[model samples]
Target: MYLTKAKDYLLLCKTIFSFLAGNSSNLISQREMERFMYLICLIFLSDADTTEDVTVVYGIEGKPISINCSYNLKENQWREKSWCKHISETKCQHVVSARRFWMPFLKRRNGTTAIADNIYEGILTVTINPLKKKDAGLYQCKTDFLGVVNTLQKVKVNVLTDLWETEAPEEPRVEQSISSTPSDTETKLHIIVAGLLGFKFLIAVLILIIARSLKNRTTEDGYRRENEHQLFPVTGNGYYS
Candidate 1:
């Protein structure tokens, strides 16, 4: 029974490591990762104001995790409110920053760490989706600017419940019309509908212009005919002089 449990835990860790490897592009920026770790620590310690007790000291779990946050003036305002409320204030960018900090920690399981070459180098997005109970741990995120390293954020994730579920990605659902027509018929129908609509509009415009021109031409022709009849005098009402 103990061996089975141990094997399960190992499998979970492997799953997390594979996930990180697939998204190596996201792990490139160390600064963003550092900030994300700090954010997770804050989430874990939401119940306690300070880390005076052993529970808080040990953190929610034994593992040490890191996250990264990028510096952006527009997002800083939002981060302040998010720090307390855990709700964003029109700073989606800051929310994204926080997520970057959370990803690595959430991806971790047990005490195993997944490290890669240049995991924290430049701009990257670290994300932890569908957070699990195992994700709760000691988290840190740091960044180096101009060769000066600064710890931008630190946080610990603590999960009290046995079941941990992260947010699911929303997928766009498309309903295709049920029709199994030949390719030629489908193409013809599409082209015909488009052509008819375009031709109808063009015809309407042309008719209006042509009607106005014809009316003007008719009026001019009538005036010219009347002038000719007046100039040529009729002798005694159709009797020859």
Candidate 2:
């Protein structure tokens, strides 16, 4: 639809061109010349793609992100530029009003929004700091020429609440070699250590009990043995003594 209108506008321009060329003897008025020039400028600025060239920009909530808008560096560097929230092709709410005179290299910041135009690079960068969910929507980079605003770029901003919502790069897989069973040698060593410890503990206990029993028997026997003259003491098993 736009292409057809552009073609018709171009045909009109050609007709105007023919009129100027054919009527060389008849001088054109200053107002007529200005109108012709305005029409040509309008046609040049209004040329657009069939579908809007909208670049999708993803930003994390509470983080700063910048959107770049490129334009004809030769002609548009000195023109008034704006950063706006786009409602429709012709209608937009200006986020930051158009700067009448944009200094080529300086960055201008207004609250949370910033605009930096680099004429040498032919890129206008709009930075939004600590973005909110409400800031997510369609936006435009606009340039004003002779009272007509031309959109230099269209951007769709998406502010994500979670970092995980963004697509993450895939990690490489690692291959590990592992065996679940224990080695025979290790099992045998453990068993041997356990057995030695148990054996030693049992032998020490037995020796301690025997020494205690002998000491007790000797003390009970020496002075209280029956007849008091035997190499071996006899303990009275049947009586209370």
lDDT of each: 0.41, 0.70
Residue pairs with backbone atoms closer than 3 Å in model 2 (clashes)? none
Question: Candidate 1 lDDT (Cα, whole model)?
Answer: 0.41
Model 2 agreement with the true structure over 1-241: per-residue lDDT tens digits: 3445544654555566556645643234433453454446343534432246787666668888888899998888788887989677667888874344545557777778888877777788899998889888889998988898888988878665532223335656658956676675676577789889999999999999999999999988866775454555546884332
State residue 42's C-alpha deviation in candidate 1, in Å. 23
User: Residue 53 of model 2: what lDDT?
Assistant: 77
Quality of model 2 by C-alpha lDDT = 0.70
Index of the highest-TM-score prediction: 2
Model 2 Cα shift for residue 238 (angstroms): 99
State which candidate has the highest lDDT.
2
